[model samples]
Target: MFLTHGMNESGELVSVADVKSGHTNLHCPFCSEKLIARKGAIKEHHFAHAGETCMESKSTIQQTGLPFYDIATGIGKSDIKLLDKFQRYDNVWLSQKQAETAMYLTQGGLLEPSPNKPEKYQLTRLGRDLVKHHDSLLQKKIILPEATLQEQLFPARLAMLQYHDEMNGTQAARFYQLRLQALLNQHLYVLKIHLQQGSTCFPLIKVGITSRSELALRISEIKRDLQQHGEVLSIEIAGLYRHFGSLERLIHKRFRASQFVIGSHTEYFHAIETAHDLSLLNLEALGKRTVEGAYCRTTYREHAHKVRVGQRKAKLLNNTHLGRPAKNAENLLTDHPDIVEAFHASLSLRKANTKTGKAINTVRKVYAALKESGNT
Candidate 1:
C-alpha cells in the first residue's frame, strides 16, 4: 500500500516519501507504531507496522457495510442471516470462518463471549471504547439500504441452510458448486491485467470491473482490444467486490495522481510502478493465486473442514498422532526405535563412532528446536 500518512523528524505528519533520508524516528499516524519505509523493486514505498498486528489495521479495512458490526454490538443475528443478507444485497462479505476468527480474537474482554448463547457474542467495554475511539478518529455517514419487511425479519430463516455442517466429498462438491454459482450471480468483479507486447513500448495496466455473468464476455472484449494494439502478456482478476462501481472509482481515485500514467491512455498506468497502489484497493487479493490454484484450494479446504469436524467430535478415535504432536521428532524417536536405529546404522558403528555420536546429538537438537521454535 502507498503510505497514506507518516511522521518526520519534527514529529510532523507527512507523506511517506517526504521523510528525511536519515530520519529513523518515523511513526504511523494511525497507530503511532514505528514505521518502516519499504522501497522495494516490486512494491511501492509504504508504511508497515513494526509489530505483527495493529488495531489501526483492522479499523482501516473497508468491510462493505456488512451487519457483522451489528453482531459485534451484541445484536442477535444468526450467521446464516448475515450471509444471506450480504448475498441478497450484494454487500461485501466476511466468510463465516473469517468472522468467527475475529470474534475469537476479542472474546475475553475485547469481545464479551455469550457462553449461554454461542452465537450471540457482545462487545465489552474495551471493545466498545475502541470502536468509539476509532469512530471519533474516522467519522463517516452511514446509509442503510432500503429493504422489504421480509428482509428485516430474515433472521428467522437463518437455520434453513446447513452450510456450516460437516460434509462428505459429494456433499462438499455440491456445496462448492452451488456456492460458487450463487457468488457469481450475486456480485460483479474487477479484472486487472498487464497489457504488454515485446514489440510495444512499455507495459500498461488496465483495471476493469464487470458482473460475474459478463466476466467471460468482458475478457474476450479486452483480449480483442489488446490484440488490435499489442499482445496480452497476462490477465489477473485482482478482486471480487460486490459494489464494483464504487470499488472501481476508489481505485481510480487512488492512482489518479500516480506519475506513471500511460501517454496514450490516461486510464492506464505503468504496470510495475503502480502495482502496489492497485493491490491496496483489491482487499481480496490476500494470498493471490491462479484461478485453478484457487479452485483446488477451495476443494481441499472443504475436505479438511469436514475431517476436522469429525476429529473434534470423536477425539479418542484419531490414533494418527497417538495424542502426541504429530511432527514432534523426539516423540517419534522415542516411540519408534527403528527410526533412531536406522539413523545410527547409517553412520558406521566402528570407524565413524564419533561422527555417529555427533549425528545423534544434532538430531536431538534439531527436534528440540522444532518443538520450542528456537535456535540452540
Candidate 2:
C-alpha cells in the first residue's frame, strides 16, 4: 500500500519506518492529510493527526458520496466476490487488474480529470450520482445472447460487459446488445484472419474503452478501424472472467485521489478491491500501439484481461524515477534492508517460474551482500 518510492529493487514498494518523514505517505482516506501518526492505539487505524506538528483533519465520508473502503467492502462481501457465490468460472481468483476493469466499466461519464495531474483519474459528478442510485443499476439478471464464436469468445465478452454496464437504462442496454447482434448478423464467418506469407511476422495493437451506445453507433466505425489495420481475428470475448460483476465494481472503485477506471486490463477484479493500478507497460510507447509498418502484416486481436502483467509494472514504476541500485550488494544490504525483504518475498512466491527465479536469486545475492556489509 505504501512504497518508500525510490527503490534498490525496481517495481518494489519498500515500506519505510517513517512514511511521513519520507514525504510519501498516502493521505488518510478520511482526513485529506498524510498525517496518520502511529500512536500504537486501537480504533485508530487512521485517526486525525493529533501530534503538535499534526495538520487538522476530518473524516471524508459524506451522506451522498461513497468512501473507498465502503466500495471495497461492498464488492468483496457481495455474492459475486472473487469467485461467484454459487461458484462460477473454475473457482478463479480475481487478480487486482480484473477488479479494476469492473470498477471503471460501471461508471457513468468516466471520473473527473484533475488539472494538477490530468493523467491521474478520479470520480466524476455523474459517476457519483450513479453510485447514489445503485438500486436502479442492480435491477438486471440477464446476460445478453451471442450469435457467433467471436461473440462467445472471452475477451470480447468482457469488453461487451464493460460496454453494457455503461448503458444508463434498459433501453440503452438493449440497444447496445443489439450492436453485437448486428455485428454478427452483418459479417459472414463472424471474424476472419489469414496468415500472411512472409518472413518477418510481428503484430501491434491499440485498445480503448467505449460505451455500448458508442459501440452501437460506431459499429461501422470500429469495423473500419479493424479493417484498416488487418484481420480482426478476435474482437472476441477475452476477459469474460470478471464481466459478471463489473457494474458493482465500477460504481465502487476509487483510484488516484478519488478517481475510478484506472486499470486497462480486461479482468482486473482484484485491482478494483484494493485499487492497485500497478501494470506492465511498454517502455517506449506508453499505450498499446504497433508501428505503421510492423515486421509484416498485423492482426488486431483484442482480449480483455483484468491486469497488465510483467512490463506494465516496470513501466508504471519507471515514472517514479526511483534511483539506481546500490553500488554493490554489500552497499545495498548495509543501506536498504526493506528492499532486501521485498526481493526475498518476490522470489518465494510460487508465482515465479525458472526465468524470474534466476533474476530473484540474483537480487537475493545483493541482499546477502548487504547483510554481510551490515555484519562487518
Candidate 3:
C-alpha cells in the first residue's frame, strides 16, 4: 500500500514523494524510525520502516476491532458480553477508538442499546437479517470430493490442463506456474474515484491500487483528501485482480504524462471525460487483456494514449520555459511520438535482469547531446 502521509524530521505530515534522500529525513508515523521511501517506477511510491517493526499494523487492528464483522453479528447481547466475545478472539485490551466504534454502530441502528442497563444492547431487525444472510452464505456446501495429496500438490497443473485443452506439455506447465503465482498473490485491487456532480469546477478522476486489508480506511483517507478540493459524492471499487502489481505498473506507465500530482504525490491520472468514459474503467475492461501486454491489447489504450498526449501537449504549451522556442533547440525532441513511446516501452522492460537501464541511459545521452549542440 502507498503511504499517503509520513512524518518528516520537522514532525509534519508529508507525502513520501516529497522526502528527499539526504535533506528530507522522514519517519514512519507508527515506528518513528527513518522511513524507506520506495520510488520504484514499476511499483507505487510507499514509505516503510527500514528494519524496525511498525506498530501501525497491530494498532490499527486494535483500534478498529473488526467493526465490520462485529456489526454484522446479531447483537442480542450486552456490551459486556460483546466485548468479552470480541476479546476472546481478538485481543485482551480494546482501544478507546474501538469503544467509540461500537457506540457509532448503535447510532447507525446496527445495535439497539437498552434504556435500563445502558450498557446492554440488542441487534436491530435489519442487523439480524444481515447476520442470517451471512450465515446462510457460510453454510453453503461444495459438492466436490476432498482432494488427494497428489492432486492438491498439482492442482494448478490440473486446472491448467482442464482449462486449456490445446496446451502442449511445456505450455501447460508454464500456464500452471503463472496461475499458481496469481493464486498465491491474491487481492490486488485497482480502485477509482470520480468527483460528485456540481461539487467542483471540473470533475476529477483518481486511480490507485492497494494490496492491504484496511481498504475502508484507505477509501476514507482518499475521500478526505478529495473533499478538501471538492465535495465527493461517491467512491467506487473499480476492479479487483490477482497478480495485479504488473497490471498497475502498466497502467501508470501508460498514463505517465496524464498523472495528476496532488500534494506532490503522484498516483492519479486525470481522466478528463464524461461519465461514460469513466464507466469504461470496470473489472471486465481491466481483466480483458493479457496481464503482461502493453497498450495494444488493452481496452482503454486508445483513450489513455489520447489523454496522455493531450496532457503533455497542454503542459508543454503552458510552461513558458518548456514551451520557449529556440531555432536549434532539440529539447522538444524528447516529446516526439517515437521517443515518448520508446521511453514508456523502456519503463515496461525495467523488470528483473534487463538492459533497460542502458537503453534509457542511451536515450538520455542523445537528448543531452542535442541540447548541448543547440547551446553551442
lDDT of 3 by residue, 26-108 (tens): 76655677767766546556666677656653443222221121122222234435434432343334468556545544554
Clashing pairs in 3: none
> Candidate 2 versus the native: TM-score?
0.17
lDDT (CA) per prediction:
0.42, 0.30, 0.45
User: lDDT of model 2 at residue 265?
Assistant: 21
lDDT of 2 by residue, 214-234 (tens): 233333544554455344343
Best by lDDT: 3
Supply the global lDDT for candidate 2: 0.30
Q: What ranking emerges by TM-score with the best candidate at the front?
A: 1, 3, 2
356 Cα displacement, candidate 1 (Å):
22
lDDT for 12 (candidate 2): 26
Off by over 4 Å in 2: 1-357, 365-376
Query: What is the alpha-carbon RMSD of candidate 1 to the true structure?
Result: 21.4
> Residue 176's C-alpha lDDT in candidate 1?
26
* Lowest lDDT block of 10, candidate 1: 141-150
Best by TM-score: 1
